[model samples]
Target: MNEQQRVMQIFQAYREVNQAFFQVMAKVAQKHGLTPLQLIVLRILKEFPDIKLMELSDKLNLGNSTTSGIVDRMVKAGIITRERTESDRRAMTLKLSDKGTTLWEESNDMRLMLLRPLLGLSEEDQQQFHRIQTEILTILKTIKGDVLHD
Candidate 1:
């Protein structure tokens, strides 16, 4: 194959791998009663409970309307609470409710269970995997943006 053809084949393989990974994650999230995007939002909220809607959108790389819809659904499901900042009083912040915390913990347990076999790899192999994944992510981020902030 020509160099260009070889590069296209590699790119296609990468896309397939990513799609498969996401599909598995989606199935797992569905089993846990959450969509993959909802799970991601919950995880982000767990880490940054005081995040604003705009900040959340920026962090998630989602449009405002899309993030708002997710937030609305999560709120209705009692998985998240929107509260006004005490100081700002008008500015809103996102936080996980007790229910949300429980769901997050359970989801984390499920993920850990699924990852146990990967964790069982030899220490060197595990480290190598981490290093390589990080390098690939760095390259992807760089391609998307100059400083690779994400």
Candidate 2:
């Protein structure tokens, strides 16, 4: 195959892998009575406790209004807590509630589930895959503005 065909084949493989990953994640999220996005929010909050709405929105690559709606639902569901910052009363920070923490912990199995397929590869293959992924990510970031159009 030519370079263009090879690139298209790689892209299709990546999409298939991504779709399979998300399908597994969606099932896991449903089992926990949460959306896939909500599960992602839980993971983010676990990593960055007491993060601001705008910061979370940036991390999620979502707009403020959309993030706000998700946060509102989470708050109502008692999965997230929003509290006024002591330094800036006007600003609010978000953290996972006790329920959210438990859910996040329970969802840890999802990582193993996702890794199962990758584990089938030889160790050398895994290392090469990681290197390729890192290189692609770096190249993509560097050329993002010039070659990639949103």
Candidate 3:
């Protein structure tokens, strides 16, 4: 196939795969009484114990107001807490609450259960896939930066 055709095919496949994966995850989230966005925020908070609201907004590609609304809802639900930075009282940082941590842990367990079996490929195949995925991810990051960098 020509270069353009090959790139298009790969892009289409990637989009479809991601769509399928996220659809499954959406079902999982619904089963847990959480939306995908809420789960994403909870997971991010777990990864970064104390993250700034502005930083989270940028990282999540959300508007400041939207981030604030999401955080407010999460706080009301006891999933996360936002507090002033100890060193800089004016700046706010977010941390996962006990409920959030529990949800995050459950989500992780579910994901691991699904991924472990698929990762049992031959060593060579695993290595090849890993290398290719990394390359593609790097290229995607570059493209994303070009499009979104402010």
Candidate 4:
């Protein structure tokens, strides 16, 4: 096979892996009465602790109104809380509530359960896998290959 065909094959494999991972995450979220998007929002909030609505919208590539709607539903579901600044009531911030935190922890535990076998590898193997994952994440985070840097 030519280089192009090999690259296509790799992408195909990557797509399948991503799909499988999404399915697993969806299932886990469902178990906690959340949709995949809701779970994603929760996870993001967990990582950042507290973030403004506009920032969340930007990060998710969603509109402010759309993010507000999602946050409303999450608040109703007891998954997240929105607080208005005392100095500026119009400015709202989002954070995971206690219930959401518990849910996040449960989901993480489930992930660990799923990966326990793979994580049983030798220390060196674990370190190598971690390093490879870091590199892949860094590449994925780059903006369109930074053409100007080339």
lDDT of 3 by residue, 1-150 (tens): 999999999899989979988987787688777888888898888888899988899889999999999999989999999889889999989999999899889987886776677777899998998898899999999999999976
Weakest lDDT window of 10 consecutive positions for candidate 3: 111-120
Please, what's the RMSD in Å of model 4? 3.0
Regions of candidate 3 where Cα sits further than 4 Å from its true position? 140-150
Q: What does the lDDT come to for candidate 3?
A: 0.88
TM-scores of the candidates are 0.83, 0.92, 0.84, 0.79
lDDT of 1 by residue, 1-150 (tens): 999999798689889978977877787689879999998998999999889999999999999899999999999999999999999988999999999999999887887777577667899998997797788788888788965555
Local distance difference test, each candidate: 0.89, 0.92, 0.88, 0.86
Task: For residues 1-150, write the lDDT of model 4, one tens digit per residue.
Answer: 999999698679779978988988888888878888888898789888779988998888999999899999999989998888787889878899999999999987886677678767999998997797687678766845786567
Candidate 1, after superposition: displacement of residue 81 in Å? 0.2
* Model 4: how far residue 46 lies from native, Å: 1.4
**Cα-based RMSD of the predictions, in order?**
3.3, 2.0, 2.6, 3.0
TM-score, cand. 3 vs. native: 0.84
- Residue pairs in candidate 2 whose N, alpha carbon or C atoms collide under 3 angstroms: none
TM-score winner among the candidates?
Answer: 2
The count of backbone overlaps in candidate 3 is 0
lDDT of 2: 0.92
On a 0 to 100 scale, what is the lDDT of residue 36 in model 3?
87
Instruction: Output the better candidate (2/3) by TM-score.
Output: 2
**By lDDT, who's the top model here?**
2
